[model samples]
Each structure stands twice: as C-alpha cells, then as structure tokens.
Target: MTTATVPAPSTRADAPSASSAYRLSFGHLLRSEWIKLTTLRSTWWSIGLVALVSIGLSLLMATSLASFAGDVPPMPVVEANRQAVQVVVFSTVLTQLLAMILGTITVTGEYSTGMIRSTLTAAPGRVAALFAKAIVLAVTMFVSSVVVFTAAALVSGPILPTGPLDLGYPDSSVLPVLGAALYLALIAVMGVGVGFIIRNGPGALAAGIGLVFVAPILVMFFPRVESFQWIHDAAGYLPSNAGQSLFMGSPMTGITLEPAPALVTVLAWTAVVIAGGIAVLKTRDA
Candidate 1:
C-alpha cells in the first residue's frame, strides 16, 4: 500500500488558505444599514409624503400669493420672490416629522424586533454601527428633502414673476434653498442619535417630535408667564426656531434668531445629541 502519502497538510508558503476570515468594517456597516433602510416600506412612504407635502403646499402657496391682487400692499419683485421661496421651504416643516420617524426607526426598529442582538453580535461595536446608521439616515433625508425642494421650486417657477422665482437655480438665493435641505438632514441625524439613546420606536418618535415641536412652544410660552426679555430671546435659539432661521427670508421683527447664530446653535445641539448617543451606545444593552 503506497504509505498513504497524504502529505501532511501543506503549511507551505503561497498555499491557498482553506478558510478566510472577514472583519466587519465601516463600509460593511454602512452597507448593512443601507440595506436595512431600503428594505422597509416606511422609507418609501416617508419620501412620498415629503414630496406630496412639499409640492402640494408649494403650489398652493404660490397660487395664493399670486391671487393677492389689490388688497395687499404692493411689494418689490425681489421681496415677492423671497416670500415665495420662504413658503416653499416651509412645506418641509410637515415633512420633517417623516424624516424624524425614519431616523428613529433606523435603530429603534431593530431593538423592537430583537434584531439588535444579531447586529451587535455581528459588529460588536455599537458606536460604529450607530455612526453608520446616522450617516445613512442623514444622507437619505438630505437627498429626499433636496428633491422635495426641487419639486417645489419647479412648481413655484411658473406662477411667480420672471425675477428670482424664474429658474432660480442660478441665483444667489440658492444658498438658503440648499441650506434648508441640509438642515433636514441634520435633523434626521439628530433623530438617529436620539433613537440610539432611547432604543424604542414610540419613545424616540415622541422625543423627536417634542424636541422640534413642543420644546419651542414651551420655551416661548415661558415668557408669557412673566414677560421676561431674556426668556423671549432664548426662544429664538430653540431647535425649530434655529432651523427656521436657516430658511432664506427676512426674520420676523423679533421672533427669529440671526441666521449665523441660529446655525451655530443648531450645530451645537446636534453635536450634543451625537455625543450622548456615543456615550451610551456602547454601555447600554441592546
């Protein structure tokens, strides 16, 4: 019998490995998050809702503005165009709730379904996972919001005069037009951070809504109690108020913050939320 020359397992250099190990990386985490996001029907519904709200309200606003004949004081064409852009951007307020819900669900949904255990098991780095999810959420929301605003601009173009509203893409006013979309993306990431901290859908949703909607109301309401000047000024720095300042328009006499300060405040708020999420993401249970 040919001494079963099953030559000892070849450990020679350049030998083809029998097995391979794959390490999870940021790209893999991001791809996984994207897959999870796209597979959900809510993502499509939210995007559709954003489009419907932005376009519907934008057209309605433009039509209404155009109909204002002799009753209102005549305004300059520049002012009219500014108001139109403001109205178009305002439509995003309603759609932002959808973005927030999407962001919250990105992480909280996994926890609700007990899928987080598998996710953590695969990655073993909660912060990396959360960061990836945040990136996905922010990018999608940004693109969706940009599309919504683009649709709004197209609809508003036909109704408004031939000034800034006519093919406004090349105008200087485009800065705030694009800035509003970027702001929505930031809001979405803020939702992701909150979701990671809460780890529950309903709770995270409520928290997000309260922060953008209710918190400003409460903060503004405080001044009515004692008519405190500082309290009233402080309201301008609230999250929603800051976001509103980001839109291109003349700030209402006293209610809105300066755009520069508001931008800083909004960035600070997002940073705080992300830091909180990072601190607890690794320490908390799935």
Candidate 2:
C-alpha cells in the first residue's frame, strides 16, 4: 500500500540558530577590531611611549623635585613626601597623546583605507560594530595603562622614599594608578567616538586633543581676561581636567568640579560623544 508520503518540512538552506549566530557575529566583530588595533605599528609605538613616559619622565620629575627641595621653604616631612610622590602621577598626561592617537586611528584608519565599508558589510548592524570598536579600544587602553602605571609606581616609589618625599605607597600609589588607568581608557575611547564621528584622522586627532587639552586651556586661559574671567570657572568642568580631579584627591588649584561631580562630568562628556557617534553611525552609510 502506497501510503501518502508526508511532505518533508521545507528546510531553508541559509537559516541557522538565530541566537548563536548573533552572538558569534558580535564576537567576531570585536576580535576583528582588536586585531586591527594591535596590528598597527603605531599601536606599539603608543604603548612604548606610555612605558617611556612612565619610566623616563618619572625619573626627570623626581630628580627635578629633589633639586628644588633644598631651595624651598621647609614643611612637615610627611606632607612634603606626599606632595612629592604625587608628581609621578602626572606622567599619565604625557601618555594621553598616545592614547588619543591610538584611538583615533582605530576608527579613522578604517575609514581612510575604505575598510569601513567592508566592516559595515560584514556586520549590517552598524551600531554594533561601532560599539564593538569602542569596547575593544577601552579595554585595551585601560589594561595597558594599569600595567604601565603600576610598573612606574613600583620603580619610582622607592626612589621617592630615598629622598625626603614619602612614597605614600600603600594608598597613594594604588589609587592614583587605578585612577590614571581609567582616565587613559576613557580618553582613548572618547577619541574613538570623536574619530568615528569626524571620520577624518587628523581632524579627529586635533579635535580630540583640543577637547582634552585645548578646550580646557581655552576655558581656563581666558580667565585673566576681564569680560570672560568667568570662563575660568568652567575650566574644571572640561573632560580631561574634570577627569583629573576624579582621583588626584588633593583639591586642584583651579575652580574645578568636585571629585564626584567631576566623575559625572567626564562620564557625561564621554557618553555624549559615544552615544552621539553611535546614532550617526547607525544613520549613515559606511
């Protein structure tokens, strides 16, 4: 007896498990961005520059401070020490240039080379790809910053104690290192956001630097000018300057945001750029 054959369910050739496929897409996209970042020769230069800033510049400032100590007015040894050790923390600023460069290239390089089209093609969800780049850039910069900062602290900490300066090792060394790392990471990823939005490497780099360095300078620079002296009050609110207040502990000299408010300010700035970039990225062609 010929039983009527039940129609075999039609299997779509291209269909796969939706959830797993989606996860893999983002995972692959993230790894691709990471590999691209690391593969750049400039990335290594930037990393090396961080290490150099930590090692080279730390020694310079430490020695310079020591030289000035004899000429300066006397103070409590412990107070003097804490102040001396803090100078090493400022090395993080020199590294900010490299961080900005690395981050700018990560996004703008793709655009310059026309690889962004391929990136968009591979991941049709443009926002996912842009966000993935940001995530990778942030993690990379933060981890590297931590390693360099901690190593510099270790090398410089003992040297400080040798002089009249207190090392402030256990607490000061730890907090500043962690804080500096987070700041660098935020700066770098903020750069990525700027790059993705501007899409011009040099223009983005200048904008990022200006925001981190110039805007604050402008905000503060004109404070001496009579009509705009109020602008000085706004300087502490600039992203990098506000971010500096985040862990520098001792109140900064300027009219900067308080630490808690400064943290919020920096985060707000970063969120605005990154979120704005993501919105633009989604709406634009690759």
lDDT of each: 0.76, 0.74
Model 1, 1-286: lDDT tens digits are: 5665444557666556655345577888999999999999988988888888888888787777668644667566656656767867877567668777888887788888999898889888678888888898888888878788877887776775432353444343566777788888888888888888888788999999988877766764454445576776776776667877877543322267766787898788888988988887778777
Residue 28 lDDT (model 1): 89
Among these predictions, the greatest lDDT belongs to: 1
Tens digit of lDDT per residue, candidate 2, span 1-286? 7888755445655556456555557789888888988898888889988888877777776667667656767666555545544665677666777788888888899999999999888888788888899899889888887787667656665555344334455454455556668778888888889988899999999998888876765553454666775666666777777777765653233465665787787788889989878877888777
Deviation in angstroms for 32 in model 2? 2.0
Q: Which candidate number has the best TM-score?
A: 1
Q: What's the TM-score of each model vs. the native?
A: 0.85, 0.84
lDDT at 230, model 2: 65
